[model samples]
Target chain A: MNNYERYMGMVKGEQVDYVPRIPILMHYAAKHIGASYADFAGDYNTLVKANIALAEDFGVSQLDIMSDPWRETADYGAEIEYLETTCPQCLKHPLEDSKDLSLLTRPEVGKTTRLTAAIKAIEAYKAYGYKEYSITGWVEGPAAEASDIRGVSNFMIDLIDDEEFACELMDLCVDVAIEFAKAQIAAGADTIGVGDAIASQMSADMYERLVFPREKRLVDGIHEAGGLVRLHICGNTNHILPVAASLGVDIIDCDWMVDVVKVRELFPKNTVIAGNLDPVEGIMESTPEKIHQNFIDLYHKVGNPYFVNAGCEVPMDTPKENLQALCKPIQYNSSI
Target chain B: MMDLKDLTEAIKTGNRTQATSLTQEALDADLTPQSILDAMVVGMDEIGDKFKRNEVFVPEMLIAARAMNESMAILEPSLVKSGYKPLATAVIGTVQGDLHDIGKNLVSMMWKGSALNVIDLGTNVTPDKFVAAIKEHDAKLVGLSALLTTTMPSMKATVEAIKSEELSDVKILIGGAPVTQSFADQIGADGYSPDAASAVDSAHQLLGIR
Candidate 1:
């Protein structure tokens, strides 16, 4: 089976020839193609070229529009500034100085914007896939999108002090994100990656009461749009793992800080857990042999329906040999 | 007639108004500014310890810190009038090519709560800027944060730059998502913190302070 089928089969609980690697590789992918990060996030052609190159090189399973988090925020009247060597920065948070819900109006999903570029990129992936590789479109989850527009500190304070405003803002974020996910699915994306890294830092009570329902709606919306869901939350998520898993997302990405063994305890045998490897120590700073061994051990520990990946995005300067070791195929083992 | 216990409880629960007013009440009751400050610090330390153990997360820590900050605003003028002095001065910033600063900002607030005088240099700070700030402030402690591995080399360069300046007394602490104790040792940082809560302990350990 091809990479796409392998991933889909894994998700569908069918036996795959081997586990598929789906490491989010934005900066590293751009570096592979010798393109500045500005070009990578700005032009969908560059974004697709880089992700495709990495997949060809490292046997990555998905072609994702994972350049940055500002795509959805851009549609919310935020001014994003692209840098040559780093992810684009949101120049001005639309709601930085205030919590005015009236300031937000949802953007038309297909209108010309960062997201438009992403949909075009998804179409390119579909054409290139020849109905094989999985094509991924991304959206900021409610909490992350709210953080992007309101600034992290401001949004955190809002979550504490003004629950009404925070929920309203997040509701709006989920609405825009659902329409954007649908547009991406219409553009031939087979998967929608929801990034809610902000939720990783939230209290279980706060996340459960406020963010989870909205995130559940977004995940449900994507599923309704006929797209698989990959939930990516960077950093330690020991607090909200249960609620996050209950969203019924197709895949849940575990960061390095998350104990995969513990994550396995929370998820069923058929659930797809992408990773729990430190991008720095486990892969980037490790030798090929050590990395190969690491992947082998993580695979066994995590059991079947697993994806080879770092806890987060592959670091920019990770050795190509180390990645080769990371993607080296391991025979499937059933946990059931 | 509410005592500093009420102030500590206020900060603990992140009740900013209560924290602020209780601190003022303590001062009005002829309680020493240092004692009132100590009460607020006790509240912060409780929150910090809870954060370290994962009992509380950033939002709660921030709210608690905000409570402490509002209380500090009321208590600061009195403390200055009473000739208060911070434990030591610190300089902190996110290394160049990294704009993410929530962790750095948290560390700064925690350091401030710990009674250290912190000068925040903000995000995307260059190595030369770090050295300049260290030299200018005569800071005895510095904290460097970098969320990106690409900026890690910049962190190493900053450490080397600071060392090259013969600032032996200036202890350097490094922390971020990608940083580790090994990375810290390799880059010659005096200490490393895995999270912001542990950052204060790392800084205190590096500087040989409580």
Candidate 2:
């Protein structure tokens, strides 16, 4: 089966040729194509080229349009500083003052430069007829987007002191995200990746009360748009896994700090659970043999409906052979 | 007549206004600034323990830290007037190529709550800046932070840059989401803490203090 069919089969709990590999790559992909992160993030053609090249060469199951967390934030009137090699930084958050929420206006996703670039990349992927691989479009999750719009430190304070304001801000972010996800789906993305790394830092109670419902809304919106949702929240999400599992997303990414067995137990049996590996220790520093063994161990614990990926973005400096080991297929034993 | 317990409770609950008022009242009652500061530390220590136990989280820790900071603002003049000196000096920042500062900020606040002098270089700090801060402050400890796998190389480079200076007296402590004890050893970091609360203990250990 092609990568697309393999992914569909695995997600559906049906038989597949092998486990699908869907590691999130950003700076790493830019390096793979020998392009600066700035150019790769700015130009849709370069972004598409880098993703397609990595997908073809490494046998990756999906091509992600994830360059950095600031894409949607930048389009929302925040001042973003783009570095030559590093992910762009949000210099001036639009909602620096929580009261400035009234000043904020959601940009038209199809018209904004950054969002349009991502949509155009998805269009390019479809134009290139890379139907065998799943093409993913990404948007910031409510909490993460709120953090981006109002600096992370400031937003965390908002969650405590101004619950109403925080909820209002998150609502705006979810609305924008829904629109952006729909635009990308219309532009040919099969999956929408929602990144909410900031949500992991909150207590389980806070997440359930403040963040989870917004996330559920975003997931429901994507499903309504005829696209699958891949939720990637980087960091230790063990405390919030129960709530996260309730979002009904197609895939849930567990970071290295979470126990894979616990995650498997918390999540539904058929939901595609991806990763719980330390990107630094499990993939970057380990030998190819060790990396493969790690994957095998994780696969054994979680069983099928699993995707091979690191807990977070693949480090840019990770060895090619290590990643190759990750993408390499393993023979499944029916008895196990 | 001021109740130190009230001050402690204020800090613990992250009631910044109450903490500030209680601190002022304590000072007006002729309470020694050291004793008032100790009360705030007691509150922060409780918050740190709860954080380690997973009973609390970043928001709670941040609020408690804010309350402590507010009390400290009221107590600073008295502490200095009484010829107070920090336990020791430490320099801290997120390494180059990383802009995430929440973790680093927590560590810095914990160090200050523990009565250590902190020279914060903010985020995306280079190795040279770290070395310079250490030299300038005569700091005994250097804390490095990074939140991205992509910036781990920069952490390694920063560590190498500090080591090259042969600052044998300096101890390097690193922490972040992607950082590990093994990675710390691989990069020649003197110490690593899994979380910000433990970072205080790690800093104390590295400095040969309780």
Candidate 3:
């Protein structure tokens, strides 16, 4: 079966020839194409070329239209500082003053430069006719998007002191995410990845009250748009695994700090689980033999309907052999 | 009936207005500025411990810190008038090639609440800048942060640059989502902290303050 067919089959709980590997490669991909991260993030052609080249070279199962988290916030007029080899930084938050919330309105997806660039990247991947590979479009999850728009420290305070305002802001972020996801879907993205790294920093109670409902809406919206969802929250999410599982996204990524055995216990059997590897130790610093062994142990713990990837973005300096080990197909007993 | 204890409670619960009012009332009641400051410390200590126990998370710690900051703004003039001095000077920033700073900012705030003079160099700080700040401030402690594995090398570079400046007397502390004790030792750092609250303890430990 083709890579896309294998990935979709696994997501659908069908038997697959082998597990699919869809590691999130950002700076690594940029370096693969001999381009600076600033160039990769700023130009859609750079991002698409880098991703396509990396996919071809590394045999990764997917190509993602993801460069940085600041894209959505940048479109909202937040000040961002692009770097030579690192992800772009959001220097100024748009909603620093609560009064700015009233003045803020969602930008049209196709009109905004960054968002349109992402959609165009998806279209370019489709034009390349790599039907065997899954093309992913990404959006910030509600809580993360809110944190992006409002500064992280300010948004954290807002959650406690002004729940109503937090919800209002989150709703607006979710609306933007829905529109963005739909636009990418229309641009031929087969799946959408929702990154809510900030949600993992909250307590289970806080996530349930403030973050989960909006995330649920984003997930449901993406599903309705006829695209699968990959929910990635970077950090130990053990406290909110159940709440995350209940969102009904096709895949839930567990960071390195999360217990894989507990993830299997908390998530339903059919749910496709991806990642719990310590990106630094399990990928960047390890030898090929060590990486292969780590994945073997991880797969045993996480069980089937599992995709292979690092807990977070693969570090830019990761050895090519380590990645090769990661992409190496597992030999499984068909009986199981 | 609103005493210093009320001020502590206000800060702990993140009631900014109550914290401000309680601080003002404490001053009006002729309470020592040190005592009021101590009350804020007590509140931060409680939140810090709760954070260590996972009973509280980032938002709770942030709001509580905000409350403490708000109260400190009212109490600072009195403390300065009474000749209060910060414990020590600390220079902190996220290392170069790393833009994530929430953790660094939290540590900076915790140090400030604990009465340490913090010189925040902000994010994407290079090694030369770190050494320059250390030399300029004659800082007793330098805290380096990096949230990305890719940036860990930058942390190492900063640590080496600072150490190479013949500031062996100055302690270096490192922390972030991807940092670890082994990595700290590997990079020849003086200390490592996993989170912001413990970062205060680590800072004190590094300086032989407590």
Candidate models: Cα lDDT each: 0.87, 0.89, 0.88
Kindly report which residue pairs in candidate 1 clash with one another: none
Chain A TM-score vs. truth, each candidate: 0.97, 0.97, 0.97
| Candidate 1 error regions (>4 Å) | A333-336, B148-153
Model 1 chain A weakest 10-residue run by lDDT: A104-113
For all predicted structures, in order, the TM-scores are 0.95, 0.98, 0.96
Q: Which residue pairs clash within candidate 3?
A: none
Q: lDDT of candidate 1? A: 0.87
Q: Is candidate 1 or candidate 2 better by lDDT?
A: 2
Q: Is candidate 1 or candidate 2 better by TM-score?
A: 2
* Interface RMSD, per-candidate values to 1 decimal: 1.8, 1.0, 1.3
Question: In candidate 1, how many Å is residue B67 off?
Answer: 1.7
Candidate 1 CAPRI classification by DockQ: medium
Tens digit per residue, CA lDDT, model 2, A73-113: 88888888878887887789888865677677566765778
Residue by residue across B1-210, what tens digits does model 1's lDDT show? 456787888998899988888887788889999988888888888888888888888898889888988888898899999998888999999998888888898899889878799999999998999999999999999999987655787798899999999999999999987788998998898999988878888888878886
TM-score of 1: 0.95
The full ranking of all candidates by DockQ, starting with the best, is 2, 3, 1
